[model samples]
Target: MTTTATTAKDLFLTAMDRRFAPEVGQGDLSLALAGAELLDLLGARALTLDGDRVVPGAAAALGDVLLDEASAALVRQPPYEQVEDWLWRRGRDLAAAYRRALQADGGLSARRSGRLGLGAVRVEPVDSPARERAAARLEAAEPVLGALAAAIGIGIAADTEAGQAAVPAAAALEDEPVTTVLAAVMDAVMELEAVRRRRSIEEAAFANIWRAP
Candidate 1:
């Protein structure tokens, strides 16, 4: 299938657009986007990981601003840092940056609405074919492509059968460490989502803690 997605961010967003609700929480998608960025860097040979530490590879610009920024950050660092620390701190921002980039690229469309005098905005795919092609690519089952599809499927919809089917293929990727780190990143994303859910519940409880007696 032909696709416009030349980078991991494009594929990640495309997958989200295809499978998730239009109003999916930004925090949840952000975690996936961050994982996509890391995967792109690793795929491009612009970065590498030493054990749990991410190391800079050859200096090269990915052209995409968010990717370039990530590459530059890795290069500026001494040599390496724990993957967990770097991912947790940088993932959300990277996701936001990619969203902006998507808007500029005309791959995403924004909509505005109001209900009961309250305003809301949301983003969705501008072109359906882009996402369809991305989904087809995910099913291609090539080493890198399959690994990516599995990692992303796990991150966003591990409870679903599709996600489960993608899992075993991840082990077949040439870089075993990449699969390991990708799993770690997915775990971090799940952790962040859990935290968000807890925070929301806590806030709701607090808001109703002192009801009118």
Candidate 2:
């Protein structure tokens, strides 16, 4: 499983493209990105799954800078972090981190618009082998990526008009660890949505009380 392209990176690319998964909220996308990193760590043999807990293996400097950072951040002790816990901890603002990393590597380019072409800048992915590979994976509906993308509302329908996978990609995965991570990501994402809804309701209620006076 010596993969050069990372799931996190692919997820970022997909997020950037409006055609892939538009309307994805940052919180859910961040959780999925963290899950993607964890999956890559599993593939790289830098970590192993003990039940739903993540067990750190030997610290390896995975060639990607952000991945190496993820490896260094692993909980290297007994009572290792649970998959759900890891998603919350590592997933906080993870999307912005990937965006910055990609911009640094020229993987992203900002295009400005206006009469003088200097108004708001829209960030887009650059042409690179990494992006090409990620696009290929999405189009082919590679299970791990398809499941992750699906978790964040990006569907296999992005690839096919029939939108018929027979079964959902996540349910169809044979890889237990990958499946576990995907499930955790989905749960965390749902939890995040619930939290946002609660906050929004509370805010609205508070505003209404002030208006009543």
Query: Against the true structure, whose TM-score is highest?
Result: 2
After TM-score superposition, what is the CA distance of residue 171 in candidate 1 from its true location, in Å? 4.6
The residue pairs that clash in candidate 1, if any, are: none
Tens digit of per-residue lDDT, candidate 1, span 83-131: 7776766665655666677777776777765665356666666766665
Q: Write the per-residue lDDT of candidate 2 for residues 1-213, one digit (tens) a residue.
A: 223568999988877765676567888889999999999999999999999999999987888888988899999999999999999999999988988888888888888868898798777788878777877777666788877887888754634642465136446788888889989998988888899999999999999999995
> With candidate 2 superimposed using the best TM-score fit, by how many Å does residue 172's alpha carbon deviate from the native?
2.2
Error of 2 at 173 (Å): 0.6
In terms of lDDT, the best-performing candidate is 2
RMSD of each: 4.7, 2.9
**Clash count for each candidate, listed in order shown:** 0, 0
> Candidate 1, which segments miss by more than 4 Å at Cα?
1-7, 15-23, 112-119, 128-130, 141-165, 204-209
Q: How does candidate 2 fare on TM-score?
A: 0.90
| Every model's TM-score | 0.73, 0.90
